[model samples]
Target: MTKGLDLHFPHQTGFLSLTAAAVSHQFVNEAKNWTEAQSHCRSHYTDLATLYNTDDVNALTQLGSPTGSAWIGLYDDLIDSWRWSITNSSFYGPGETEFRNWNVPQEPNNAFGQELCAHMQSDGTWNDLPCASAFINFVCYGGNDQYVLINQGRTWNDAQSYCRANYIDLPSIRNATENEKVQVVANGNNVWIGLYRTRTWSDGSDSSFRHWNSSQPDNLNGQQHCTAMSFSDAGQWTDEDCATTLPFFCYIADRPTVVTLRAVVDAADELTEAEIEETILKPLREELIRNGLPNSTSLRLRKVYQTNP
Candidate 1:
């Protein structure tokens, strides 16, 4: 539904049809904290580098040959990170998705940053733990308040897959009543719930691709929430403290662009098309420059057609 940036003037509306910008990585040898590096990237180029696959990872390795690790865009979202495997928002009611019954102060402590998934205790209170390490019995909800507790053990992801294939999904404890029902299914043992969290990127990209080093993202001391790719480690990723200053990589779109805009204008019969283009291009160019488009970057209005709204 949405195209590129749309520009609006007092008597004119313009639709910016931007050809995709070819993204590239840039390495900054200067050391700075994760937040500071992000600010620098936004000010100078695009946001921090976000790798989606091995190809993208390999591309960053070719940048200015250097040593030491550098920050990328990935980071652990410590707040409001828990989510259900059944991601359909319609499955939940008002305040239902936000419901949590953790065992409190010590439960989701993320001890060493390894506890990204949650399981329910015998008492119905939840605790976060490593999803893969714990192969435990899981509960599956089959709608209409039906909960099935399977005796077989499986990892959280596996359980989610199994439940999705067989039932609705892994159980979602929306309230104490639902919790009690699911807790009863547990029959006095910890069982996997649908609650889990995942890290995010600075540019808000939702690519699930990950290339962490062995046993990385350990969230050491619970302070390592930022991610960095170690050149010495074959561009593998690891989580570090957000405040730790380090050289970082930034991405910018370097390829040329040709924009086709559909503009509507109301003007005196004497006005020329060039004048209309100038008036619209001035603000459009300013917006582009303010958003980190290089000054030397070529910008031209390929075609401006008058269309009936």
Candidate 2:
């Protein structure tokens, strides 16, 4: 365990396996108020790390010692319910509100009339604390999938919104092969994907299902709250805290053929011969000329002879 922090771990039967995946980063509450703590978390580490589910919580618990509580990135004051600072949205998963393991007692009791901090105790339960109390340190998970790279940088929330606005769900992997493909493209950077435990799909619904790699999506820390793709590893999927501001991946869905054409012109049928010649043929001719095709090539017009009168 690191000095003042109580970092615990699960018992391993064989050689203790310690991969970058198992390491987690946390922040300490140092007399900083809510807003200040939020800023410190954002500026220092990734955003306040949000728990995905029970599995994620368990994994994080290993990082603690036998004593002391750790602060997480969950709070209810900004919104009506518990929300992640990374996405600034409510935490999604099976039994969101009823999950006692994550929350001690339907809290956000807004206790002290100003409770906005959460900590993990030695027993693995969560307790709400005053934001100004400087007794807690938080944890962070860093892996390849926590971040997304784009032409320009953006917040995880922005990345998620951009994917939803432009594509189907965030990018999803159908199998290990696809995951490997994504990893190759990602290189060493983390990217976002379309797999979250927001809700289960309906019976017979194909679009909502996720095919995780074998032995994957262990929901490591708590609930497998966030989704990321690993490149150094086997392009496998890993669950992470959403607030961990790592890079994210974004994708644009294939637009309908008609919509694509309309984007270039008002409508395909509305294009005039002159317009086509000016916009299409002229450009092609210029490109051909640039490529060494003869610009002066000409053809003789054929005429038909009249027979009568």
Candidate 3:
């Protein structure tokens, strides 16, 4: 074969690792509804926080805020529509967005088709309640997986803001063991968990990651449309209404997407450096674009001289 060329995707700011991408996050301590929060984030930064992965969710828990909850970029124009809080598509994988855990594993209901908000019940089960009902206590966790349960009650939206500003998004339970950890801190009270089904991102990204606290998304009262991260059982998702305005989350993203590449070739023709860049490396970039890669990225090239084998 001809001489080889290498490709790399570096960070926009600095020389991060080859596998790193550059993303920025900024938090707004102001209290606002979901609609209001998005407007503020878009105006000041990018938009209300969006989650690329569980890591993104965990990172927000580290922020510090005084309110019990705030608002996030996640919202649904359709009753049961769901999506990620952020607009990026690279963070999703197969069967990731569809992950869900319901108390009633057999036949689940949609909060009886009532409203659009969700909260955790005692024992970590979920229920669809009105989001605008009132504020309630919520649990906040950190990147190290440490958590603090807020005794004071706040609206679901309010709770989210508090956790994000102070810690991370509502507790994201991975298994029954982790759920037990949250249950102890719950103190026998039904607290909010991070699970819901509003099938549409405010930024218009699609995600199918669902973690219901069992018997969730029931659509009870036909009014619950929003969601809360429940803590009673483990950290399951619940449904609630948008108007209820419970303590909720306000998030910022710290996502980066950096890629690095290196190549080795048998130098028989001994082509010039420019020929390698134009004939070989240039095609690689074009192919990446054809595959629908983001065009706003900054690309660079590097050269190394080695004696032929």
Candidate 4:
């Protein structure tokens, strides 16, 4: 009887199916060059996609469909350095070791000078190539905050000026969320933000208020005082002095409220609109009326919008 009896079992395939669905949804493919790819990823999909670990990369590989090369949001121009195109920080896990394919000396001989471009090979390893090379198909990721996209394509100084004229201050990173948000927006290109250590906030003199992720403000072997954001390292901040001539980030406070007529026109009318404001409006109005006008003869009654209360 026991041998003939059947037992019910839970279907485990559902979980695998769900995982496959998720992997399929996160993959993206587009055709373009480095700049064009960046633009397409930022505009159509997400600003910058994140590669947290090997699993994420694997998921992306699966989503790539038909098994061909695609451009990822990662690259480095300096040396054998690797960084995320969004934050420009070196925070990717060790899993990337299995995915890297160095050309010969395993680093940048700077052979062609600035020929720094990384591409995903069919074998799933990354390789450096000349940026001028045309390629098709790019992958994108989701999960980034909505930030102001400044496509200045200008040098760092000009970019700073543009940010200042339009916003409150250059971009600032208070926490990881903001960092990721910026990274996602920039995707795979270098951008600027509002953080630097040129002048000390305390005395307006050099006091070294530089904040960095690791041995940063490393100045990379020099005393770099200004800072700029790189898409290579997950938006991690670094200082390189103000004269480095890189893009900058600016942060604008919310729009200010427009002045109202009633707010400007006070009881005394003695204090000019400039003098009386929200805090000082009533007090100055009272004080002016109490003190009275210095030159009564000079005062002329203008047409009143409302009868004097």
Candidates arranged by lDDT, highest first: 1, 3, 2, 4
**lDDT tens per residue, model 4, 1-309:** 011211121211100000001111233444444344445545554423333234334444454544333444332222223333322123234443223333346542333322334433333333454444433222222223335656444533444445544543234343545555555655554444432212222111111222234645444443343333334443444545333333221111122222112222334333221122223423433343355421110111122232333
Model 2: per-residue lDDT, tens digit, 163-259? 4444322333334444454445445444433322222211111121232346643444343444443433333345444444443221111221110
Off by over 4 Å in 2: 1-24, 27-32, 78-309
Indicate whether candidate 1 or candidate 4 has the larger TM-score: 1
Local error of candidate 3 at residue 157 (angstroms): 0.8
lDDT (10s digit) by residue, model 1, range 1-309? 343444444344445454436687899999999999999999999899887568777878878455689999998877766777775556779999989999998889888777889999999999998889546899998889999989888889899878876787888788899999999988997899999988988877555679999888788888998999988888999999999999899988766565565655554332223344356655565566567764323344444444444
Per-residue lDDT value at 64 in model 1: 41
Q: Would you list the C-alpha lDDT of every candidate in the order shown?
A: 0.78, 0.35, 0.52, 0.34
Worst 10 residues of 4 by lDDT: 12-21
The number of residue pairs in model 2 that clash at the backbone is 37
Our tally of clashes for model 3 stands at: 116
Measured with C-alpha atoms, the lDDT of residue 15 in candidate 4 is: 9
Which candidate has the highest TM-score of all? 1
| Best of the two (3, 4) by TM-score | 3
Cα lDDT over the full model 1: 0.78
Candidate 3 local lDDT, 186-241, one digit each (tens): 88777766554455556554333555546776766666555554333333456656
